[model samples]
Every structure is written in structure tokens, then in C-alpha cells.
Target: MKTFQTVRGKLSGQILLWVLLAMSTTVYGQQSPITISGTITESGSGMPVAGASVFIENTSFGAVSDFDGNYSLNAQLENKDYTLIASYLGFTTQRITISITGDDLEKDIVLAEDLLSLDEVVVTGTGTGANRRSLGNAVASVKSKDLTNNGATQVDQAIAGKVSGALVQQNSGDPAGGISIRLRGASTISGSSDPLYIVDGIIISNSSNELIDLGGNSQNRLADLNPNDIDKIEIIKGAAAAAIYGSRASNGVVQIFTKKGKSGEPKFTFMTNVRLNELRKKIDYNTVPLAWEVATDRNNLATVEVERYDLQDAIFDTGFGLENYFSVNGGNEKTSYFLSASHLDNEGIVQNTDFKRYGFKANLTQKAFDWLDITGGFNYVRSISNDVPNGGINSAYGAITGFLFSDNSIDPTPDESGVYPVTSPLVARTNPMEAVDRFDFNQKTNRVITSIA
Candidate 1:
């Protein structure tokens, strides 16, 4: 019985020793996690590209480069062969075969510039993703150079006579007059004919809603935008382009993209503009007093000679405009920022009529994750105008209407008390000179547009 127990204990001890040896061998044979480190740089320039995405292809293991353009990624894999990818904006993506055989790897990647990136990207009303050549709808694009180089004070004026298959018409000769654009003709007979306007991915109000009764010559909301801040304008003029935004794009869509910072050192820009406006020509007034009085007198009776008065100088003057704009833009690969401020004071040909505007805009873009990017925009504008009524409705108090119906025989010079006498009974008891001087037609608008996407 003693020999049997001893044999069983020896067997148990041998089995335990073998198990311990196998466990130790297994633990020692395992390899460490594979780490891939690299620096991403631009081709030719050799500038370090921060915020670059570096990862193994078809795998979740990835890392974004730090500000120094250095990145490190770790992965535990059973396979020895894999593909590595490095990508950044405005540069061509690079992929190379990498073999990780139980050792850490160091590989530097250089990406070439993507020359076709600017031409291929399209800003549709829905969003910006697809290439321009891939779209089936007819889209008209106006770049910043075309829009801002026209000396236009208003955004609507910048695109005037520039877009194809669209009619841009000013509502009146008033300096702050509203603009009407008809894309695909009038959408509704009673409603607005203006197309929907989208700025920086936010649908904004381009309403011609008359805040005050300026005889339908009230400024449109599009005037609030600074023309110099516009980067691009895209118009989807076809109805078939509604695959993304549904019925809201019925009247066609106008997408406005503001300027953004480029990947480089900080750049500052300052612009000043001076403009002068004068009457093109005067109307042929009846200067012959004998012809006017003799032709009007039906009884062939001798009447008092009619005096001719040149009131054109009193009603019109050379308008002067001064504008100043300043902008600063800068960024690294990880983030980019743009800021701009502008002020404009534009006088009108009509006395006591002018438009003044103050504008500020800021845009920012940040790479939050390998697959995610965040962009934000803020725009603020305040406009003040000393407006004068001038439209086809012919309001009784309209400055132009009063001038039209007034008799030239009576002088419009103000009296000693600074009160103007009524010149004619035809103008609905409203004096043109008084309306131009003391009508107190003032309109002010403050608007702020913000977006995050």
C-alpha cells in the first residue's frame, strides 16, 4: 500500500512541473504590441503637416498628428502584412505597404499637393461633397474675384448682369433700394419671386419685407452681407437638383460661401474704395416760356410770362462714397481662422439720402477627429439709411412723385422761417423740397447669422 501511494504522488508532481514549464514558454513567446511612428510632411516644401490622419488601412487603429507633425499608432495583430495610410486636406492621400514582424516601425510620409482639388469641389445648395462635373443639374458659379472686383456695395449688386438665365432688377433708384431676382421666372404671382438664399450652410431670410413703408423700395436682407467677404456664389437653377433639400429649393437656390483661412502664416489685407456718382443726363425740359404759356392758354388771351427754374441742382448732387475693409486670416493644419471687419458710407444723388453699414465676420475650422471636422461661422451686420421713397406705386409722399407732378413755375426755395411753401396743387399737398429735407425717412437694420456644422 505504501508503494502505490508513492507512485501516485510522483505522477502528480511530474504533471504539475510540465504544466508550469508550458505556461512559462507560452508567456515568453508572445510579442509586444506593434507601434508605428512617423512624421507627415508636404512634398517639395517639406513643411510638417499637423492634424494629418495616420492609420492602418481597414483597421480602427489610428492617430492624428500633433502640432509637431509627429504621430504614433499601436496595434496588436496576428497578420504580419498591412497597409498604412496618411492623409491631409489639400494634399493627395498616400498609402504604402507596411510589414510589422514583431518590431516597432518608423516610416515618414510625404504627400503631394492636390492641384485638382479646387476645381473639382462644388458648392451646391444642398451641401459640398460631390465633384462639379458629376452633377447633372446646371449650376452657375461666381468666384470671389468676379463678385468683389465689380465695385458693388451690396451683395445683390455684385451679381447683377453676371449670372446667366437670371434677371436681377433693382426695385427703384433709391441708394438702399431692394433687389429682385427671378430664377425660373416668378414662382408665385402674389408671393415673392426671389430665390431661396443659403449662406454658409444656413438658410437665411432674403425677405423683401418692408419694415417701413418706403413705397416698396425698402432694402432687402441680402444687402446686409458684405460683398468682399463672399468667397463663392453657386446657383442651382434647375428643379432636378432637389435630391437633398426638398420643396424649399423649388424657386431655385442661391448658395453663398464666405471666405475661409488657408493653411499658412497669418495674412492681413486692407482695402479702401472711393466712388462718385452723378446724373447721367438731364431730361429735356420745356424752356420756351412763350410756347408753354401760349400753348396752354386756350382763350388766346395775353397772360403772365412763365418763369423757368432750374431745380435740378437743388434736387440732385454728386454722391460720394468711402469704404474701408480689413481682414486677417491664418492657420496651421490643425485649425484655421478668418476674421474681417468693414465699414461703408455711401451717399446718394438725392439730398439727405445715404446708406451706412458696419459688418463683421468670423469663420473657424477645426479637425476634431480622424473622421470628423467642425466648422463654425458668425456674421454680424448693422445698416442705417436715410431713405427716400421712389417706386412705381407713386405714393403721395414719394420724393420722385412729388417732383414729377410739381409745376416748374413756382420756386421751391424755403422762406425765412425755414418752412417751404407749397408749389403746386397737383402733388397731393406734399412739397418735394420739404420731403427731401425734413421727411425723416430713416431705416435701420441689425442682423446676425451664425452656423455650426
Candidate 2:
């Protein structure tokens, strides 16, 4: 009987030990942490996308991807039904629903680019990227295709009426006429009100005084840039949008981005255009008889009959323009190059006025390392202008003063007297033809601009 009791007590202790062991096992299972690991990649290229964020839906548990686009998260998941979300900028968000148990789980997600979404950002203000929908400022972007389609000569002219809130005005009818650009109306009380121009990360000085003093009284400096070489243009209107550019941008800012070579098979492009330009409008001058009668009345002299002259008919003519361009681009994955040459000849509607330019450009880009890129480009342009004397005394304006309102018909050629025979009230005024043949005004300019990045 004593032996039986001892065995029974031993069995009771063993059963109690077993019950405690089962309870401890159940509690451990409920508190264990599960690890979730995964990798993220681009759907199309299958390239790993680092810096992606992965998190459980509606929870504070999350992890960030490492350099290899791998992530690991630890969580004490209570429910089997839970969702994992992975997101990154410029890519579509990915979500996966799965059951969680007391075990490690592995997941791999592939994301695609969000092309249709306007949320894709662009750099508008200096070094700042903003969504297109949230911007309050007036900005317009013109692609390379637009400039080519319009056959625009200058960058500013390419964006003319197409963009809202920006005004482009042509000051003259000449082929080389000046253009005026205004952003949200004139803001300054006095001084130049033109916008600032930035080309290829270089801020160019657009001093109005300089334009007046050195540019032969041109309206803006944007005419210095050729449209064919431009890759894109961004116009920032109003002070608020251009504040970062400082005082130079008081009017506004126009940023120009030039084209560079692309890596691919060797490519060649050639284009030529032959354009004809005629006088769009003519200014009517007073008849010779009418002019002489008016002059006699003003001078209170006896009736003097004057010969008539068609001064307008003799000064203007139909002009022609010809342009030619050729380019060659070829490169490998490590290096690329682009070279272009262009020639332009344009004649003015007015006699003895013309413009010619020869330009060449070369751009090279090299990938020195995975994260380092180097680019260098240069442009050389030489222009010649054959200009007529149009202003000042004894100039084109003077010829108009003498011929149209003269007291007598004047012949443009010299008579046997070796003196310009005048039929007008003034004898000091020379014939328009004689002045044009004797006066020759010509100017030549050569410019070289280069950039390194």
C-alpha cells in the first residue's frame, strides 16, 4: 500500500508539469514576432528601386528598402488578414493582401511608372520641384517640337500667343526686327521692363541700359539665341514666380535649355528652307504737287509748281531669305557627340539692308562613373549686317523730308552741273539715290559661347 501511494504522487506531479508546459507553449506562440522581408523592382526593367517604403495597412509598422531594394519588418500580427503597401515617388503604389501566421514570410513587389498621373513633378522654380496642378504661378513650357513646327527664328517668338498671360510684341516689320516680351503687364514705373533670360544654367545679364547703349537700340537680348538649337523653354511670369532670380527677374524669367546628344545608333539629319519675304505694308507719302502747294502756303511765297516723285516706290523691294542646316549625331553607351552647322542669308524689304549668319555647335556628353556625368558644349556664331542710314539728318529720313513735300519735282540723278539738281524748296537736300549709293554702313560680329557641366 505504501509503494502504491508513492507512485501515485509521482504520477500526479508529472501531470501537473505537463499542464504547465502546454500553457507556456500557447503563450509563447501568441507573443512571438514575425519577420516580413521583400524586394521591390521596376516592372518594365526589373531594376531594383531603392529607398522605397513598405508598411502594413492602417498600422505604424513600416520599413525602408536598402541599397538592393530589400526590406524587413517585424510585427506581432494578431489577424491573418492584413495588407502590405509599398510606395515610391515616380512609381505606382503596390499593395498585397496575405495571411500572417507565427512564421516568417517573404514577399516581392514590382511597381510600374505612373505615366497618366499629373502628379509627376517638374522643376519650375530654381532647384525646386512642384506638381503641375498645385502651382499658382503662371508658367509655360515649350518643347523642341513646337519650335520646329512654327519655323520660329528666335526662342521668344516660338512661344508667342500660344501661352496665356505672356505677351510677345514685334516692334518692327523687318526680318531682324526687335521683339518685346511682357509678363503680366508692365510693372516698373521707369527703366527696362523686360524679363530675365537664363540659358543652360548660366544667368545672362539683361541690363536695359546695355541694350540701349550697345545693342543698337534693340528691345531685348533674347534675339541673341537661335531657336533651332534650343531643346526647351520655360517662361515664368509675375514677380512671385520669378522672385528666386533676384532683382534681375523683376519683370520675369525665361529659361532656355539647349539640346544634347543621345546615346544610340549613329544618326544624321539635314534640312534646308528657301523663304521669300515681301513688304507687308507701305507708308503713303504726300504727292509732289500736294507737297509743293503745302510748302508754298507755309512759306507765304508766290505760287510755285513742283515736280512729283514716287519716293516710296524707289526705296523698298521684295526680299528673299534662305536657310540651311545639317547635323550628325552618333555615340555609344559611355560617350556621345552631336555636331551641327547652319547658314542663313536674309535680305530686308528696304534697299541696301541685309543680314547673314554662319553658325556651328558641338556638344559632348560622357558618363565617367555610375553617379558622375560630364557634359561640354560650345557654339560659335558670326553675323554680318549691311545696314542703310535710316535715321539722323541727311539720312533716309532726310530723303523723305525732301522728296515727298517738295515745291518742284526732283530728279534723283545729278545733271550736267555736277550738283544734285533739286526741285524742292530746299537746295541743301541731296537726291535719295545719290545718298544711298555713297553711304555704306556695315557691321560684323563674332561670338563664342561655351558651357561645362
lDDT scores of the candidates, listed in order: 0.79, 0.69
Residue 294, candidate 2: C-alpha displacement in angstroms: 7.6
The sequence of per-residue lDDT tens digits that candidate 2 reaches over residues 402-431 is: 444443356666669767655344545545
Residue 158 miss distance in model 2 (angstroms): 3.0
Worst 10 residues of 2 by lDDT: 208-217
TM-score of each: 0.71, 0.65
Where model 2 places Cα greater than 4 Å from the true spot, the runs are 1-120, 205-221, 287-306, 392-409, 412-436
401 in model 2: Cα distance from truth in Å?
7.8
For candidate 1, list the clashing residue pairs, or say none: none
lDDT of 1 by residue, 304-373 (tens): 6777666666677889999999999978656889999999999988888898999999999886764456
lDDT of 2: 0.69
TM-score of 2: 0.65
